[model samples]
Target: MAGQDDERGHDERGQDDERGEGDERGQGASAPATWRRFARERVAQRRFAARQLAELRGYAGRGLVAGTVAVHLVAGLAPVAFMLGTGLALRDLGSDAAIGWLALAAGAFLVQQLVAPVQLVLSRRVQRRVDAACIERLATFSLRGASLAGLERPEVADRLSQADEAFEQWTLTPGAAVEGALALTARYTQLVGSLVVLTWAAGPWAALAGALVAIIARLGQTEAFHRWGDVIRSLAPLRRRANYVRELATGTRAAKEIRTLGLVDWLDDRYVAENRAVLDTLWTRRRAVYGAPFVAYTVAALIGSVIGLLVVARADVDVAAVSVAVQALILCGRFGVIFPESDVKLVYGRGAWQALLELEDIARRTGPEPAAAAPGARLTPQRSVRLDDVRFGYTTDRAVLDGLDLDLPVGTSTALIGVNGAGKTTLVKLLTGMYTPQSGAVRIDGEDLRTLDVDAWQAAFAITFQDYLRYELPLRENVAMAAIAHRDDDEGIRAELERVGLGSLLAELPDGLDTPLTRALPGGRDLSGGQWQRLALARALFAVRHGASVLVLDEPTAQLDARGEAEFYDTFLELTRGVTSLVISHRFSTVRRADRIVVLDGGRVTEAGTHDELVATGGQYARMFDVQARRFADEAGAGSPDEPDDPFDHSAAAGAGATGGAR
Candidate 1:
């Protein structure tokens, strides 16, 4: 069952090879219950981000925006005051003061015309300042100490995306809030100024009737807008599905496979299915939310207009007085919708801001700091690495490395050969401090590994993993990353590149050392599988050149050709002359020359000895070699030894060490 799972995973990896690799950028979806929990936990963050808006104003320092808001309020009131002043001037004009009437109308219009653009530009500038401050603060706070893995989590990704959108929302809301407040304020300011003028011209009853209409209309719109906000929140599942469809279609990594596998039609259908699901839900909810408010607002507006006309008829008001009063009522009606829309925007903005705050909290707890390489000389073994009965498992039911005790003496290369499921890679990870042993200790120089700083402990070794990273970077960077701290060591880097047979490859590149080494990028070409393997070897060799003491090569040259494999081993043996090494490979021919060969089966060392001694003993190693070599012997007997088609070519093996399967 475990073998089947391993094979399945390998196949999946092969299929995923079509994916384009890069710095990933996209959001993921959260489970419904997870989103609910996130919302609850993030309440504090929302409160904090809300406080940031005020902090943003403070950053602007009250000098420009603070006085600007005050001026806006004064300017907003001027229109209403001027309208009343006009009516008063008209009354004076009818009583034979034409100059006073004309002066009043001209002055009021002039003030409004001048203040409008000044207030508009100031408000626009303030919104920009506030929005920029929020985005910068959120970005700094979220990225302060975030881990590489945290960037992959669905909730964190979603929050990051929401935070970006929230900045845009904040921009709109600040402008709306300022404008809405001005609108609401102007309504009242006009009412007071108009009431004073009407008291002289008409009566207190007409003034009171006008005030009632403005308040009632605004109340109706506020209720409608809140209902709309609630409706959108209820459709989050459909919204998330729609977003996932977009990601599948548009993500760079998913694109190649999606096209090659003929999944375009299937994915397009899925996108339409999800889009329809969202739109249907939205349409159904939109009617209920928007219908009631539309009816209520219409009723309120009609009522307000009716009352205004009755007041005008009973007062028998002059045409100018009637005109000003009607305009005030119309302005008040527009304020009702504007105020509620601003409130709805604020709610959504708060939700997004809270999500950002939650991400910051997660980042604080889980993010790892980038470790700086500590200066050290070519690692000469102060002491050997010791494993005192270490136990490990990736999951609870299956133990990959169990109570395994092993020791590599200082300045010796030990080859660990194992069956397919024998946990060689896991053992390598445990030795390197990438993972902690469950039951025992992996120590160096009598220091407990856990007690040493993780970064410092990891620096003690350099390894070539079976699953090596194929970095889409320059040829020099790809090789030099193994010793990244040696930024200026051009001579050392060139020497290692030459040692690994990549010197010619680098020279052939258009820009030499600076040329990019990936087809994914502009002005770059991809290397063949064997060439890439050599590049990987060069990377490990670069690490050795830069003073790596313990070299762990796990199935490192599985992709190399026969001659390349022989050359790699020869180069490796030379490079690790003074260092301790652990070489784990399935290739038994390669292991025959090691000082010691340890055969592991089911996480236990079943056989350990020199290759010649193990062959003499005729144990697991000897039997496996017989099974493979027997096939070659049978084929040799069937074919002529002198012919070009000869089955056995011992000459090539002699020239470039025997290279073939040990699996």
Candidate 2:
């Protein structure tokens, strides 16, 4: 057990090293120069705020903002009103003027209470609208290029993470920014009023004292919170690891593995350790940041109090005026001091918003819109799609697909077979225009693919991945998602579902075409694995019906039983007739039926031929096929065309043994 723990610890340290590589790369150069970077970040944050404000104006319109601000104008005057009332009552202490002053003070207090609720109600309405608009704008920005290459960039990924965090945390939303702006305006307005009262009651020194104190307190608070954010970000990977451990313990998907592998105790221990580490580190960092601020706040309060007392002791300043001045000074301290709970959220939000802005800028700079209408223009691959000397990697140290060349001629079905990590999926992604090769061109009909519009280029292919998502939507809508350009084709959808052998499944659904696909929703139901796979194929067929020229199925049978996969192979060829199709599978049973089989090894094609031709050649494809065939034949004797049962099932063998013994 101790040895296992040591092995795990060693593995984790290595994982951390790999994960931290991206962060370290930037710092490893020039011994960690950070001053300029921080300055640039601050500047970027301000620009992010500006961009949000622009989006806010567009979303809420001029009239709504003007109306919201007008309400805020009245609400923000609370401090000014408070100062006016206090000053009036104190200055005219013993006459009819004193009575008037007292009445005015009461009126001001009443106005503040009444206006506060109204301001909040109005802000809520604007907040809802602005939040929706900002969220939609962000969603649109993410899908702008319509290519997965953006997701591969580390900086882009970080930006996306930050944007998601901000949205969840509500740190940098347009509505929040607007509220912050209004609140700051109100506070500054009150500060101006307080300064006027102090100067009149005491002198310039007292007035300047309040202003300087407020500025220093705000700056210090911002700095402290920013430092805290840095600490949290540094621990993000640890948090992610902890969450993964928790998932392994509690997730439904891992239940079988947990029971079989006896991983419950290990997962629990790791979960507890990770959480404890997080808690300890959190408190330690909190102490480090909050200690100095606490001291600063105490000193500031004490000094302000002493200043108030000195002014009260002066003979020149009236007692009533000194009373008003002291009250104003107290208000200054209230406005200046930042609460870690609420103020820290704002700091985090601002940082996230800044990151989103930087991400957008990076995407814009690197993936500029072409002047040639590449996005809207189509490039049909009538002759062939070729990846010449392609190279790609998820990281700097390892290449997933290195100098790989492959060709997919029009109107041909090619089965790409490879072991795990042999770049089968990577090749498919490159061919589908989801990724661009690092040092090669994906040419279409002898033209450079980069010259075509990536979005339009993508419209040419319909693809279903092994891990296809089950969207909790109506059955028709789910299938129609493939042909989103022509989504209203109800007849077309039904026809494709029939072609993909989903007729029986659709008949079983409660609402036919309108049946929801998840149990999470009312009147919705989940389908079996084979049924879902058929639906996925139906989607691809729908896409082809709506002008998509190619169909790419990437290991679509990985989750299916042998019988289900055998049934799928029989239907797939018929459904994908004449459509340029690429079928990727590790299982050789269905792959043997393909027009051509291409074996990939070490990121390059090793051989290509018919199943018979490859088997005759007795090469890589032949060896791999032989191994898989031997397993089915020896165990169950069910893989041959004459067999009517599951090739992987041992029930037939058990039955046969029992009959032989009885005879």
Candidate 3:
């Protein structure tokens, strides 16, 4: 019975082996398919690398590239030349030719020494040119799209991060790639020269063996480097996150919050955790990718060296031939060696260059459609700017402006009022062509905005956003930047500032129009919030002075006191007379001065009329206005009469008075 059981187990084992073989046969067709796929991938990778190399060469310029390559080639051959000359000197020892051979050897040695420094200088020049060119191209590619929609994509941001990483210290830049390629060329040239010398000194068979060993060793290292590059690329998103954490902890922008909120330890811990994770993964991958190549190459090199030496020893060669063979063998070892300048830099830099190329491709694909109108066509709205049944959203999940319709009549001031998140800003962006509506149309004087030149359309508007930029430049530049053509018109800049009630502040500045706005600069001065607001107004006013027909102010007086805001609004209405103006504000007291007041709600115009008409209609606008009036009245009532009314308070007097059209 036991013998029968053993026999049964043996039969089962045999059956299992047969089944495995059958499975292998079943998958045999896929083997060729897999091989083909791998071959295609390898070919694609090589083509990409070649294209990057070509770009680097182009950036460095033909003349510099030629010089660099020539220098490296001479340097590469110097070692072989020295070995040959020395061998000749040894063979001709005690003869008249020995001195000449020695002189040749010395000359080769001198060339070796001189060529290295010259190559370094040329390489640096190439690096600078490439870096400059790369930066310029990156900027150009980033700005290719007319709308911010393409730039705001998460993938675009990630690609930008990767491209930026290429410039960081010890990382591979396009410039570095060019230098590495040159160095790689020199290394291969040296290997070839060494092989030639080996063939002459030893024999074809010996040289063939050495060449095979060198090629195998080099291929092993190249495989390892390729794997390492893959690891680095896979970790890019994590590395980018780690970098952001580090910046939050160290950068000035977050310094106040970091300290005030007692977040230093928390941020530090998060930063360390992220960086530690990155390093741990890197170390593990590095050991795995590099260990086998290192050990295998070391052993192979030792064996190949011993074998070559033995062949030379057994051969019927003179001392001179033996010496030449040894030198050539040593030079051959370099072919197997890992050069940081060439192998490492080129591999990593090529990855970065590939990322840049990918980013450019994405930019090109997602870029705005070609303008339907001629490039020179100017949009001068004669009738009105109108949005008809517009739909838009930052994300597809929800709409910020759904089926919104509005009109801003030419040569009229229209006030847009709404709660926060009421699509007020979204409407303004559409008008300026900073973004395009997902559906419907924005028309300028009956022409579809899509068919008009966007740049020309935007150039006609003088806008002051709630979150305006405080340019850290001279006062003249700050105002003149709105209309750069008037940069040299100092009198116009001063007059605009005066119109915005900043004439006294301008006179107080140490350098007057030339004074820098930020304290970071020499002889510069910082302004109060109110002063900055005035400066922003001055900029817009300056634009209006220089041919901008439309004025749009979004919460333009938020930083000003109630009295100051009231006074500015009065002046603003007068200054903007006959210029098409759209003012967006939550301050009902201020917006009441406009010719028309429109309430934006649920992504559409809910109410449109004069302020008095809207207030009398008893709708959403009336309700909101009453709510604000009561709140201000309560605040005024709570304040002590002995104390002067707070300048920044939303005055109950204005609210109550505006409710009755007192203005």
Candidate 4:
């Protein structure tokens, strides 16, 4: 055993020698590397701190912030002074001079107590405002830029998550951190005074042990927390699922379906299961975070006990001096605990702040969409809107649209046809400037879409999507959302609703146009699915009435029955006549009346032309139409006469001019 121990020591020494030689050779490289790391860390800290201070300024005026600082300073310094005065008063109680020390001690304590209430009030107010102001600004910034590509980025998404969590609820905001920073001043003051007194009364070695314990405990906790970072990150998906389940159990939109489908108990069970999983994840990591600190504290307590024994054994120690030593050592131990807690708070809070700060920096780069035109830029499309050599995808691994090109002629009803996953919806977003392409030009008339003002660009078109929102607002507001610029046009709202065949819905409303649209609101009523679709149509037509020249209806009649869909298709031309309408429909019957039809396959234009032209070509479009026609015939009966190949019974003007479905 002795030989093995000696050999092990020798081996360690040899390894140390090798490391020493490597270190000496790399000393020049190592110094600069270490300094660079330190410099980067310091710079990051300074920058983040400055940002926090700047954010704080937005919530607190200069005078109030100054006053907060003053109170904090007074409170921080008071502790050490009071401790000194208390020690003196205790030691010199028999002397007249003790009265002065007692007075000083009493005054210091009283002053700190008096300032605390004001400091707390200011801190609370700052916390409220800072959280609100910071979250709102982040939201505004997040909603900017023409493309959603930034939000899709992993780094930006993570930052937004951090900021959102912080805003939701926090153990410490920037104001709390600031106040805690000042509290740190007080803790350190107590720490130093205790060390000075302990050293003078007992010995320096006792002070050293206290300091060592404090360092070890803080380092242990901080390291443990960081070590769990990867685990926390790994739980993101689980956390998201948990959050979804929680919302599902409580959300208003899902309430109807949950009750109808008997999903209430199932939803509650899922929510409970997810919450348990989340709890388990957090609980599993608790030991790693707490073990080291607990061990260090135990060691500190043992060392303190030894110090007390040594002081008692020394016959030369005066009783008054011994008391002072005990008091000081107690303060040292208290500081050891307090400092570690402060360090823990600093680590997690700073990390959260850094994430937000990093997001802000990233937003500065490749952001704010520089090509957005001035507010007054023309919105009316005079000629046509063109997607010029456009390419885009949600992720790098898969390209949704590859070199896709198309045109929408001014005042022409063009139908876009495609199978699922053909990048149809992506095209609509690109045209609307909700997403900017990785490379391409969406041109309006002659101007590139990127360079067009976002507001004006959106103003150019009125769109009703497959998943249109049913806003729980007043009936008027539901329609007025489209004509925001002319919301006060009550008569206009009534006319638009009438145009969409919803005049009957309005008459039945308890308060007519002023009636609320959701039962969630007082005296409100929800609309049926068909009624909601008509309402969405009303919103779109309202936009057209208020100067929107282009109309986009993506699966606009999805909720309507067969009769309603056929009826809508019959009148679709009259309803959108003279408007440059781009319609997307899975039901071939509805879009067969469009002036031109373009077929999309795997994100490229496979065919284009009139319905007749496409059918004559006998390509992808003709094959699709034939399949639908056969189905209708088969359903009616095999003995029945074959139905027309055309989906709609409209006149030749609507069906004759389709360009072609495939090349």
Q: Taking the candidates one at a time, how many backbone clashes does each contain?
A: 0, 2, 0, 11
lDDT of 1 by residue, 408-515 (tens): 887888999876778888788777765667788887766666666555666667788887888888877888888888746778878887887878887889977777
Pairwise lDDT winner, candidates 3 and 4: 3
Where is model 2 more than 4 Å wrong at Cα?
Answer: 1-73, 125-130, 146-149, 152-159, 169-174, 243-265, 339-345, 361-379, 636-663
Q: Which scores better on TM-score, 2 or 3?
A: 3
Candidate 2 overall lDDT versus native: 0.69
TM-scores of the candidates are 0.62, 0.81, 0.86, 0.79
Q: Give candidate 3 regions above 4 Å deviation.
A: 1-40, 144-146, 167-171, 297-306, 367-378, 640-663
User: What does candidate 1 score on TM?
Assistant: 0.62
Candidate 1 error regions (>4 Å): 1-381, 386-442, 459-463, 485-488, 519-522, 547-554, 579-584, 589-663
The candidate with the higher lDDT, 1 or 4, is: 4
Best by TM-score: 3
Which of candidates 1 and 3 reaches a greater lDDT?
3
Winner by lDDT between candidate 3 and candidate 2: 3
Model 2 residue 525 distance off true place after TM-score fit, in angstroms = 1.8
After the best TM-score superposition of candidate 3, give how far the Cα of residue 392 lies from its true spot, in angstroms. Answer: 1.4
Give the local distance difference test score of model 1. 0.65
Clashing residue pairs in candidate 3, if any?
none
- Which candidate leads the pack in lDDT? 3
Off by over 4 Å in 4: 1-64, 94-96, 153-159, 170-179, 189-234, 255-277, 297-325, 338-351, 358-378, 395-398, 511-514, 562-578, 630-663
